[model samples]
Target: MKMKKILWFSILSLLLVIATGCEKEKRAKTKEEQIFPHNLEFAVFELTTHQACKVACGENGEILISLQDVKDDVDTNCSLAQFDSIQMMEQIKIYAYLNINGDSTRLEVPSKPCGTVSYYCKDKSEEVQDVFRLIDEIRDAPAAQGDSAWFFDTFERLFGKGASIDHTPYRIYLAKADPTKFDAPHARLEDYRLIFILTTK
Candidate 1:
């Protein structure tokens, strides 16, 4: 009788453990599916600014934007703007708006050129020539210091001298829909737009 009771207790304990393990696994799988549905990876976009000019000049510099995939689990309620990153799952399209003399004009910036090159002038470890080589391929004019330089210079060359340098230049907008589906001018998605107040020296 004693042996039978001990055996029954052991079996019950084993069943409880198995049940708990299965429950935990089910919960984890549900959470994982919620975060990365359809086996698609999610990425966070970052805009890193490098000061090309002296400290006294303020925020006058180059902007290197990068998109990195998120490895860790994220909160379900968290939005892309909350992390100061663009959400890739929504097919976000970035638009460049150049503000000249209180007038805003949308520039024809190809999506391919937008994130191709990210370089820092001060980073001595990276080959300077290699950086210039990459920039030269994408840019219309000669490679100027970095990406921001190329951007501002290109516009100025097209419009007129001092078109960007004389004033606060452009604003970057991120639309949450497909590039082809939505008209950037009509969309009122200001919450996702990041206004980069870039100036040239």
Candidate 2:
């Protein structure tokens, strides 16, 4: 009788191990299936608008998503504003401001070109910490020792400088560039995704 009991216990242990292995394999398969464009594997976050997001890309890229924006109830009241939520901010190319990280965390530095779009979170890592340090350096740096107006105009990009008037008689035009792109009268975060690509300099 004791022998039979021992045999039963061994069988149970083996079955438990097999089950655990299968579960792990299932998870591994799922991870493999989660493939993004350009063979990029990103760490995601739930971000917010007008909020500063500090992103870092190591061997494994990092990203912050404003899940809130996904469900944000946007309200806009403009004289002439009708922007296609599809082709604007969601999938625009970010060529110039690729390596900049500032005007978000520090109060001393004024935002240039464009303010950092960020959100709040509670995850910490060495890679992100390094980015913060770099931000400090950028903040302290002199303002290039010259007039910034001579440089390229971000006003056109951010505030829609030369907005095309649908009707010139009344100055009908699309909404100014802002974070409300994810809200209603534009696009919802549910159907579309605000993918912010992260790369290192």
Candidate 3:
């Protein structure tokens, strides 16, 4: 009977030790390293002829722009058409949690004048010149993750009227809908935001 007591005590002690070790391991983990509610943020800009409209992410991590008279389509071949006929442009900013699974945030702004492939139809020679000029401007801006080449390609495809877009260098991350679960494919992008920072300068 004494031996049985001793054996039971030993087993209980072993289980206690294993439980303590697991708790220690969990304490050593960091919340930042784990997927959570506040991991990432984003900002957006739109350049119009008269003034620029800016939107900053607030509590819900969203911003909306209201325009008086919005035109969906304009002449792609005319340089002045982009400015003369168009009434307004909208910009939106976003803030989100960066997670291991997929990208959660979004930017749905249409490709604007500067990043378009046609360069306002200013002839091939002048178009290249304008593109280079815009690229230089982006290089002069401040951004944590920006690239001129990304901007050039994004605009070329988006404004070039259904031109093929190469999404190889781009990456996507999903939102943490449930902290206990991780997903990868839930995140998506309407347009590339890399160019905004690349050509920000």
> Clash number for every model?
0, 11, 14
lDDT of 1: 0.33
Rank the models by lDDT, top first.
1, 2, 3
Error of 2 at 97 (Å): 12
lDDT of 3 at 178: 12
Task: Report the lDDT tens digits of candidate 1 across residue range 1-201.
Answer: 999999999999999999999999999877756543123211212221221222123335443332111111111222323434444422332333332233334232222111222224354333334433433443434453234445544533322221133343333222111212122333333322221222232
Mind sharing the TM-score for model 1?
0.25
In candidate 1, position 186 carries an lDDT of: 38
**What tens digits encode model 2's per-residue C-alpha lDDT throughout 22-67?**
9999987666454312232223222223344554445454333122
TM-score, predicted candidate 2 vs. hidden true structure: 0.21
Candidate 3, 24-59: lDDT as tens digits: 877655542343212223232332222223344445
- Candidate 2 residue spans exceeding 4 A from truth: 36-201
C-alpha RMSD for every candidate: 21.8, 20.3, 20.0
- Indicate the TM-score of model 3: 0.26
TM-score: the better of candidates 1 and 2: 1
TM per candidate: 0.25, 0.21, 0.26
